[model samples]
Target: TGKKYNSAAANEAEEKINIAIRVIADHVRAVAFAIADGQLPSNGGAGYVIRRILRRAIRYGFTFLETREPFINELVAVLSAQMGDFFPEIKSQQNLVTNVIREEEASFLRRLDQGLQLLDNVIAQTDGKEVAGAKAFELYDTFGFPEDLTALILKEKGLDYNKAEFDAKLKEQKDRSRLANEMTTDDWVILTEGNTESFVGYDQLENTVSITRYRKIDSKKDGVQYQLVLSATPFYPEGGGQVGDRGTLKSINETIEILDTKKENNLILHIANTLPDNVNTSFTATVDADLRDESQSNHTATHLLHQALRSILGTHVEQKGSYVGPSRLRFDFSHFAKVTDEQLQEIESFVNARIQDHLPLIERRDIPFKQAVEEGAMALFGEKYGDSVRAIKFGESMELCGGTHVKNTADIWYFKIVSEGAVAAGIRRIEAITNDAVKAHFAQQEKALEDINGLLKNPQDTLKAVVSLQDENAKLKKQLELLLRDKAKNLKGELATELQEINGVQFLAKQVDLDPTGAKDLAYELGSLGTNLFLVLATADEGKPMLTCYISKELVAEKGLNAGAVVRELGKYIQGGGGGQPFFATAGGKKVEGINDALNAAVEFVTGK
Candidate 1:
């Protein structure tokens, strides 16, 4: 075995190549671990942090290692194998992590290719060695290309960008973000000494309580807000994917409407736009009964849905995330493949079947976590648990949850899956409706079908009618293409006779009564007639200007005539630009009036006039 070992980090290695290896190795862990901790790559907040890190590794591999395909996702397996025992979450979510990284890699690589082309255009348009930061920032803002990566590419070409200008643009963006998300909170005005606040929303919708603490909040988004902590609350604070409860706090003098509720530092804070008239007096903490009932139905339905997915799609299904609200519920779970229409129907039926069974809720409060787990309660990943936990059970579905739920499954009435799709690599999301929402969904769908039927003149079989209509449209489209082809062929014969011998080259430049495609077809047909043929065909299709150039191979080689250069130069007449091979090219513009001007200027290229 004669295998040679080279003293190089990478082929055609540089100092940065060694740095790239370290960067990829280091940044991939941050990204993988972040995803494991229930954060996915997104455009904002903590998600943005992970996304930026992943992009850095991708760019490094793309530029230095010459990696063109998705390789970052492959690294997840190695990472999982190395740190699996220490951090079991990564090992368990290995496939999810891999798929997420792969999708992101492929998506960004496409963006990278687009950015490269845009960067090249910027370089061509620039007056000096320094590229404008505004253009670079546009690439970052519009295409998600990193600015440092932009700088690196420019540096490799013996060029540099304006750093100070880039910094100013970046600062402007950050300033706008700060202004949008700006928030300030005043210290709590303590009405009581100890923290006696607790959630009593499970048993009652209304409770007599005293104000324990209150604070004022100021934010640009919501303007002014107040946070009040009651001695005991019937309002449920936002947690475990369920939105905070909104209700009213009624004192003797006035009723203050709670806008939202949130839990911070183990304190249940009821958010309101205004404070009570008398802070020292008692108030009845009442939860919004209608909203609460709606939320509970969706929450309970979510549990049944989870059980159904695991049962029907194998035990690999796990709760990745969820949202329970008044109108609808969104459930994110771990699954390798897309849930087919058949599977969705099966899952909906499974949940509805449980609802029909009328399973009563069996809740255990303040049980040890180990005991609840040992009792076959499913604990969701990425959810924190203490020594003691509350378990909610309904028939065969049981989970360690603190969210409010229906007293009985029959309260849900019905469950319907509205949509299902992939959210990340191995993660799929299902949006569903229950009770009143399901009713509304059915009404909307029925109305849509009725409208469709009315449009089809009350056709008995609407599906068959639609298929017939599509077939007729397709047939008409084929007939239109054939007519256009016949028209182009006839036009080519007339244009060939009108060709002028410009400097020993067969040249013709004219506005054509055809589409851009037809112009292209006509030009190629004329080019194949003889050698030294240089044709420039201009057209305005439905008020949009387009230019097509076709130069024979003989003319291109003998006279060095480039069709790409011709169209690019001519494109200025129409206030647009484009390029292609030396033999054929195309350009599109917004102004149709410029078509004749572009056709007029085409002869100058051949004549050098």
Candidate 2:
């Protein structure tokens, strides 16, 4: 159902204010859920989605509701108190949700301060009774302000906004996004009576199943695909952090290759290249044994790793998200600080010990969700569960899972942690290899070691040899820095000797052979030593001209000279731009010869001499 907004008020502006309130009420749910689901308000991906939603809601309250300071964070408590019973995850993750929202709110408030000026500019351009959709879009696209915020402001001015035109612009942008991330599908056509599908993939890899439904999809982005559904197949659909199984379906007359198995709202869609010739009859479905075996091994390793993380990084660690494939497994969990190298080694040892023990997986099915929770089977927050769920218990490691796993932990062979680092604000991700991926990993590491040994002439102590080289390089760097500093001190006198007076302002404009930092240092030295000084140091290092301006505090007050503004004007001559405080500024440009002209321009612009 669409979000229902029910608040009404007496004042004319109150109508707009209520609009913002309603939007905020509706959007806060998504923000709350996304945060509980472990997605933070970041600059990209799903976090970007959360950020946009929060900003939109805040923009409404900002424009119409007259809410200036961070107010949406307060509503988090109201949301928790209201819906906490139904969705307890929000209550559990309330602090995280509130903190993320508050941080995002504070950030957008800073943006809104800047955007208000942009909004005014957009509003001013449409002087007529109607604000152009293009103008409304500018406020949103450029400034990141909500469109409704613009509408509310326009309504206050008795101006109508072009919504239909705005929708077109919105659709154009959506089309661009859709094209980039497009997945076309065809309408399903039923071939059998039943709507249910079953997976017997745990016990068997091959089965003869009848086509329940089929569809031919032609996508402009992905091209043509034939999706078929079987009554009861052994194929496992992609879900629960596991990739879809790739296999084939065979009819009596022909064999149709199954590209991938995926689930969309409990419907397992078998993506294929071609349709079966005889849709009425049953066909033999087979899953590639080698692929599922490797996947299961990695999936089991992920479970062991999850337990190890909780043991290593405290019980605060929970599954944030994961990706299990034939090659490797990537596990994301909630933790504050970085996992140290020693901690990772310990984690690896823990998992490898479990693998070495050959712990049997105690697979329990049709277990009541509540009973399973009582049994201490760790349930992933935000994941929807049925009345009865499957729980995989490996000694101490227990989790509610439906994805295929190894019969025993020993099947994983070996576990190697590839990398460990932060994924978000409070989330850490660990990518690790299992089974054949481990063997491949070791092979690559061995090869790299061999290459390094060959490069180092097979040094008996490679670590000590490398350390000695690094020490030598550091000493050389220190010597070069000292030499450069001494050279700069000498060049300062030569540059200062060329000082000339213009309109009672002690002006010096000369081309110097120095790096940017060196040039800046020289300018500060001269400025600190002199009085009534207007210094402009120009340099052309590697044919890139740069200008630095330093004006005295007295002249800045008397002559109204701004060093930043002066350098910016000088920058135009050298095809560049810059700005700074009243006393000091710097600019960089392309034209080498223009450095002298830029200095002359600065003198004429400030002294008119």
Candidate 3:
């Protein structure tokens, strides 16, 4: 009875330990959610989080479920469904998650197969000695092969591995990874007991403010810098991907420069090289009015463009990310492929249509989040939202946003897409401009056109002038090709006469004054002359040797000669390599000096002498 009681007690303790471990894993999962909510993962940190979660889930599955197959996808579905309300991004991007996980699993499986093959090859070459598991583990980790798979393969080959050494190497890699990615956060310093950051820039450019708490931080690049907090700031902090506002703050007696404004942990951080000598004194904050207006115009234009894309492309488009600044605005969205030129033209036209309409900007503050969405306001992916939200609306475009916008769309004189390209596999980006930027862009275009017209002697019909020049260029190119073809035909006859007979086989080797394309044509022409023809042609064009080799069907079968292999071998003489069908192959080389050697190698390959 006493022994049974001891066993029961130990069993209960083990159960508790397992429960604690599970709870810790759940908490780690929650930390991932929190980080994701802050949009920290989407830009660059997402890959690390994804790998961490996958490894954790896979390890847990192996320990508890005793299954090696990937289980993270199922777990992700459950977690995403549970947190769908808070983060709709997860729900919307569920397909993306599936694709990423499936690809990772497939990649890992392929690596395992490759590792097994490599280990088998390695063990076969080993001279009756145990292979170090550390070396095996290094291949596993570096190449994403599972260690268990390696062990099983090694066991089948009657080879032992140093398991302890393998574990040590794996642990060392984990330690280095942890040290590199570890981050620490300091406690926040409250400047004021206020909940909201008030912006007076919409109606006014200057405001009176009290000095908030400031701290010095050290970074890798910039040695030391100070971040200041203000009770109320007129300077717009960098948000919505826009660059920060620059201005000056004047106290009763002295002035301090406000270099840039940025946001951290939902708090506005004003970066400055130096602090005011009077730390407790009150000061007036002033924003660069012109910069502020230009930024606001661009911000307003971005909102219109978002609406324009939906109008032109489809309702599926949503803002993935954005940067609104005085100079320009960059917006990212979800799209399978590049926007066609026709679609871009329509999108640009739609945005300009809104600008011409001069719709009034309507901003509704402190609206319920659900109500905002129900009202057809577009919400961005990977953005965290609270119960109350700020909704910005134009005539047809509405979105939950906090960035500054123009009061009226008319203020945005014109909208132009400066650049458009892909940011990722499924994400497309557009950089655009408005107002002054558009004017400047058009001014540059006008100057360029004027210079072109001047060079053309102010041609009355630019289209006619361009067509005439194109016709002349085409004619010249055709004449040059004809001249080269005639020259090659004449040279082919001379080369045919010079063919030497070797061991009852015909051989021809020469440097032809023809391009790679033309040389290949000549070789084929010569091969069709008769059977048992072995041809090697070398040409130097633009200081590079173009080597071509051809063997007739009869000689290829009789001598077991592969022109593909021969060219690959001979190409080394010319510092290049290539392969093709048994009949024909060509190679390019940087070493023009090796053309003769390459031809000689080909002759040696064909004759077998």
Best by lDDT: 1
Q: Which parts of model 3 have CA positions greater than 4 angstroms off?
A: 1-43, 47-203, 218-223, 250-259, 274-283, 419-422, 498-510, 531-536, 543-545, 553-579, 589-604, 607-609
Error of 3 at 322 (Å): 2.6
Model 1: how far is 509 from its true place, Å? Answer: 4.8
lDDT accuracy of residue 96 in candidate 3: 50
TM-score comparison, 1 vs 3, better candidate: 1
TM-score of each: 0.91, 0.77, 0.69
lDDT of 1 by residue, 298-376 (tens): 9999999999999999897889889999999999988878999999999999999999999999999999999999989
Worst 10 residues of 1 by lDDT: 1-10
Give the winner by lDDT: 2 or 3: 2
Candidate 2 residue lDDT tens string, 409-467: 98999999989887665678999989998898889989998888788899998888789
Clashing residue pairs found in predicted model 2: none
In Å, residue 471's CA in model 1 sits off its true spot by 1.4
